[model samples]
Target: MKKLGLILSFAAALLFIACKTNPFTGKQTLALVSNSQIFPMSFQQYNQFLSENKVVKGTAEADMVKRVGQRIAIAAEKYLNANGYQGYLEGYQWDYNLVQDDQVNAWCMPGGKIVVYTGLLPVAQTEAGIAAVMGHEVAHALANHGQQRMSAGMLQQIGAVAGNVIIDDPRTLNAFNQAYGIGTTVGVMLPFSRGHETEADQIGLYLMAIAGYNPDEAANLWLRMKANSGGQEPPEFLSTHPATDSRIANIRKMAPAAKAEAAKFGVTSFK
Candidate 1:
């Protein structure tokens, strides 16, 4: 009981100090690690990855990646600045690269380091499609999802420690180990992961719209992504991302709002 009490108090205090609002979602999120702590590490890892991978340069495809990434970055800045969050992106050393890989994937690191694999280009199929993917990845960075996930992971670990300390009986404790694994994964972690993906989708659509790409393309992009996957996936409740149909529907509904957001920035027409 004493250990449980201490754990609860520690978690509450940590949550108080580590919470901050995400400008895009306007919701509080954990941020135990600061940009100062994460960016250098992120840069180092990015450089190491580039050294190991075949980073394409001076090619039209590579140029397209850089161009779309820059436009998305500008759109993000515009939205943040107009929303009274100026200077929110300080210390961001934005870098974009295209790598010659067969995986259809893209990602943005904590301090704006972005990598798009060559395999993704076929699915993107156009500049607008590229914007959709880039915008989503950039949104993950801008919203500080990486930091929040780290914070959540720490909390989850703390909870496990508390569980082990509280359950004194070996047989009872073994049962708890089994239950805790399933409970946390299904009840907490999977849902949390899915929520982040949906938020990224919404924020990405807005960014794409503000960058002069039609946000409606986002839904179609996801449709292509689904077709690429051949309908094989874990159940939505057990998965870390929302199901394809749910995401497509959400994107379609958000398109009008995203376009309206772009209109506020004098971007009334989209490509």
Candidate 2:
């Protein structure tokens, strides 16, 4: 009983103190690790990653990556300032790089370090396409998805430990692990990850539009991604990202609203 009470108390403390408000959603989010704590580690990892990989420099594609990233960064700051998140980006040192790799991936780290893998360019195909994807990646950083994921993981482990302590028998503890492992992963963690992906998509669309990239092209980029994947994705419930068709549909639905948002900022034209 004492162990369980202690665990509950600790969890309550975590809930109370480890929450940060997301300026975009106007909702509190898991942030047990602050950006001040996460950023230096992220920067170090980013530098190590760049050192290990072939960071393509000075090429047109590389230049486009930096160009799109800078535009998206400015758009993010403008949107945040307009939305009353003044000084939100004070410590963010924005850096962008294109890495030579065959994996179709790009990501933004905490504090605005970004990398675009070469394998993604063929699929991106145009500046608008790059903006669409870059906006999505940047949205991940701005939204603090990495911090949330890490926090959720910590909670999941804590839950497992609490569950183990509550059951004394060896066989019962074994069964608890068996049941809790799959339940927590599928029920809590997977859904949380998927939710972040969807939110990033929506936020990215608006960011791209605000940066003068046609939001309509966001859907078009996903259509190309779907083709590249050849429709062999896991079920939406099992995947961290929505299935391709669903993602494309969601982007299509959000594009008009995204453009409307851009109009508020006097961005009536797109690149």
Consecutive 10-residue window with the lowest summed lDDT within model 1: 225-234
Against the true structure, candidate 2 reaches a TM-score of 0.98
In candidate 1, what are the lDDT values of residues 171-250, reduced to their tens digit? 99999888988998899988999999999999999999999999999998989999998977889999999999999999
Candidate 1 accuracy as TM-score:
0.98
Q: How much is 6 displaced in model 1, in angstroms?
A: 1.9
User: Per-residue lDDT tens digits of candidate 2, residues 185-267?
Assistant: 88888999989999999999999999999999988898888889887899877788878888888989999999999999999
lDDT for model 1: 0.93
Cα RMSD for candidates in order = 0.9, 0.8
The list of candidate 2 runs beyond 4 A from truth reads: none
**Prediction-by-prediction clash tally:** 0, 0
Candidate 1 C-alpha RMSD relative to the actual structure:
0.9
lDDT scores in order: 0.93, 0.92
